[model samples]
Target: MESQPHNDRLWIKLLVLLAYKTATHKHARRLSWSSQTGGVIPISPKLCIKATPFTQLAEANAMRFVAQHTSIPVPMVHCAFEEKGQTYILMERIEGDTLAQVWGQRSDESKARILRQLKGIVEQLRRISAPPSIGVANVDGGPIFDHRLPRKSSWGPFATIQDFHRELRSGIDAGDIEDDASSPGVKDMASFHEQAWQAPVFTHGDLSALNILVRGDEVVGIIDWETAGWYPPYWEYTSAKHTNPRNLWWQEEVDKFIAPMHEALEMEAIRRRFFGDF
Candidate 1:
């Protein structure tokens, strides 16, 4: 497996040695003060005594995925500890610009380039064999990702847009929802799926570009898996391009950026349903 550079390892060994002799339990702190190796300055190792094993496992798995898989980039894990309520995880850091940095300056050519790259990343993610699955345990963290859905019946299919609008009014009347809850994207999807349409796909539940890293037009890495989970097929389709108001930061560019892709995903879902295999 591709591993940390030799220099980095040597550097870490020095840090470990330093930790062993510290006056206080200042392991990573003092090491970082004098650490000036490869322009890499790590955050002080967190006191993970309160972290659950589940968090450590998630960090471990994310590292493994980054190390083993070539599609999406993630951090590399060097060491980990899980005991009682305490968890310790060590991993290499990555640096890159975010996709949002370029969203605001969307030129015609830049727009096309970013869209193509985004599409390619999704296609690649679809090809990645699902990551290892972990069971529900009382422990808080682990190497495997558990992709349980957040909630069920959040939304469902509608026979027509009219039916969706009616429900929307009712929901809003009850003060349980916002007005845009009945958007064209959501309303149009009413007849397309059902409670049973949900599937088990490994997903980075929070897929916003803010969580993504970019080098030029390429998506180099995706970060922040705290909300990662198994999600339905079309779950991301709506917002992938819809540029929901929730992500107001990119709202302006999102309309043009995701318009075409959103259209394609919608039609694609329709085709799948018509094939009877859906």
Candidate 2:
């Protein structure tokens, strides 16, 4: 289940649009009105003059992190600047259609292709040298946000499916998630494999098709890693399944994605710079 931090994020988006433009029907001068890229047309290259402050910083940080470390595909940030009341983030536009919209319109016939592409992207991100972590708050003297616990633990004391499920269930109840959205509350944390899996190399917090760019069966570029976090590798499995063509509430999809990749991820000795369990 997702944290309802920005439970009405889309509504906030709408409100932002309304404030920027008197009418909601038309997008602003810097428009991504539609990011539908057929193989024939490319993704647009334009400055998002009014990109949110949070998003602009995240995009800039992600691009910098990618350039400094890994080569896995992600958009390149041209520059980030703020002027007056508007903040601008310029990025290299990927040349493929967004997987999210495409997947929704496709029948089950396209589902296999979507999953394969998704799997491939997840695999790519998993190969990164460092999982994203700031060690604390972004700015010096800012609020300290520690993901590490007092006891040394890989993936923060929860690596197996049962443990993951329990934590997720706790979140659902604590967050007061609706019944339809909560996980089935695991009966035993020992039922699933007890082996510890590696903490996240870099889990894209938001793995929706909207953040992905696909060309046929390949994921050319994953545009947004704003919500990317450091945690157990299996966390992405839950996230990807939710954004799939058919959103299977924790029951079917999350476990399926992890079962296939668990063996490969667990045996490695993790080396992360300024990375703490999340």
Candidate 3:
């Protein structure tokens, strides 16, 4: 029997398919589903479309900015349009295997090479200067603050770091609590918030193995720029560290792959614990 969630997903897929069909007159025979549950649907071998209720304008712009400013490989955006209250983005389908697909079979040397490449990419991203801010970037390349965890809801494009930390502290206080010993509750959001962040820098915002595309040993593309933004220096590290990896090795050595932000990561870990993400 099909599980409830599976059935729900199928229904949503069907609705999306119908919508796409009506809009584009495309045939399902040429279309396929991506591993992602919603929004992202493959329309052709060399192209895919991502549909979202909220505007994906920021994502589309982010990709262009990254490609232009840095050598980081992001998918080429062919088109972006809004229809029926959803934003649809058609983009190039990168021809490569996701790092997650090949990580386990890779030799230690290959893994190290990939890590080095990623570190270089991170360095490049960090070089993109931005006006001081503590949240996602808008289409104008200005700061647009939004909730960091559990949701993408907008909050404030805070002018000061203090304002950003105040929002974070509030979130911590209202967040759920956990009983695990390894998972500690954040007892002092005020004290925790006192730590100063270096100037804001461009961030990919979500850096998981699955989002990294590799052809053989070289990284060919980095997909999903929806969360790309100008943020506090620690945002990239903490956000990347917020994942729950299926690969144990990834979970173990993630800190080594990217720049280390121990204090920020610890804060995120505590937040995740409170929210039951672990």
Best candidate according to lDDT: 3
Show model 3 residue runs off by greater than 4 Å: 1-38, 132-148, 171-189, 245-247, 275-278
Each candidate structure's TM-score, on Cα atoms with residue i matched to residue i, is: 0.49, 0.49, 0.76
lDDT of each: 0.43, 0.43, 0.65
Least accurate stretch of 10 residues (summed lDDT) in model 3?
1-10
Model 3 lDDT tens row, 1-278: 11011122444555545656654444334443322424566566787777755445667777877888999988887666544556666678788998878999999999889888888888999988775444434534544533455344554556655565656555543234333466444654345655666666888877878789998889999987776776767877877766544556665656776768787777767655554352
Clashing pairs in 2: 100-209, 131-201, 200-231
Q: lDDT of candidate 2?
A: 0.43
Q: Write the per-residue lDDT of candidate 2 for residues 43-137, one digit (tens) a residue.
A: 23432222543343443555556555555577666554444544344456667787655755666656566666556556666776542332212
Worst 10-residue lDDT window for candidate 2 reads 267-276
Positional deviation of residue 252's Cα in model 3 after best superposition, in angstroms: 2.4
| Candidate 2 deviant stretches above 4 angstroms | 1-26, 29-50, 82-87, 104-117, 131-197, 243-278
Candidate 1 residue 138 C-alpha distance from true site, Å: 14
* Per-model tally of clashing residue pairs: 15, 3, 0
When 2 and 3 are scored with lDDT, the better candidate is: 3
